[model samples]
Target: MNPASHGLKITEQDGVSRIDFVERNILDEANIQQIGESIGAVVDASPRPRLLICFENVEHLSSAALGALITVNTKVKARDGQLRLSNIRPQILEVFRITRLDRLFVIHGTAEEAMDTFG
Candidate 1:
């Protein structure tokens, strides 16, 4: 499925579905919602979703964005699918750690590594 906003880019290959968050900073409340919705749309459209969310270009994530990620993670779980994260900046990673969300989500050094988990 095509993303409603340009903040994300979706790609599927080798039975692995990936969504790359294209924005430099996911600090805007609206953009955060858009990213969550786009993720939901892509997961809804997939037959059997195995999602990798790449935060390679995202330097910062706001509290709302963090909430959105949690929401999407729930959606993925409800679909009996998997969700992984990759390329998170150190500062953002610290946020995840502080929130203890790092334990809630499987994170990787790269999108490729996250995608491989689906295999």
Candidate 2:
């Protein structure tokens, strides 16, 4: 399913739903909401989803974006699904660390690494 309108590029392989952000900065609240909704749909579509969100193109993200990610993570967990975040830039990783989200998420250095973790 193509969700380009939501500024995301999605692909699936080996039962893993991988999402990549099209925008470099995800600071807008409206865009963040759309991203959350789009990803939520992906999570709901599968009984046990394996989602990987890659931040390779994203350089900056607002707190609202983090909230949206949190919401998506909650939905995935509620459905007994797995969510992994990869390719996060150093600056954003610092933010995740500062907010203690690093502990909440199963993050990896690369999408390949994250993909390998999916059971």
Candidate 3:
């Protein structure tokens, strides 16, 4: 699915990449790869100290998304940077909690709050 059609807006703020994903069935491998590759491209293009994902419109995340996050986290860490997450939906947060990713990732209620914490 095209992100713009659903009003998905992915942008970067102060080195933090905010991915406002519209509600879509991100359960498939293609979608997962697409999302990961996009973010990976951004990471490759930057020299920033950190990579933060502010998930605004995403209500649910497939395990694929979680895997992508881990990949990004590992990649960022390899470069001596951090990968953070914010603006998670409560339901999605539950998934993270169940899987212990909530502890793995630096989650926040809002992107502003996340930036404040990181800064």
lDDT of 1 at 16: 70
Best candidate, lDDT: 2
Which residue ranges in model 1 land beyond 4 Å of their true spot? 1-3
- Residue-wise lDDT of candidate 3 within 22-115, one digit each (tens)? 5444566776777777677666666754666777767667898799788877776676666778888788889999999888788888878877
Query: Judged by TM-score, which candidate is best?
Result: 2
Question: What's the CA error at residue 17 for candidate 2, in Å?
Answer: 0.3
Clashing pairs in 3: none
Model 2 clash pairs are none
Ranking by lDDT: 2, 1, 3
TM-score of 1: 0.91
**lDDT score, candidate 2:** 0.93
Query: Candidate 1: worst 10 consecutive residues by lDDT?
Result: 1-10
In candidate 1, the residue pairs with backbone N, CA or C atoms under 3 Å apart (3 or more residues apart, or in different chains) clash, namely none
Ten-residue stretch with the least lDDT total in model 3? 1-10
Clash tally for model 2: 0
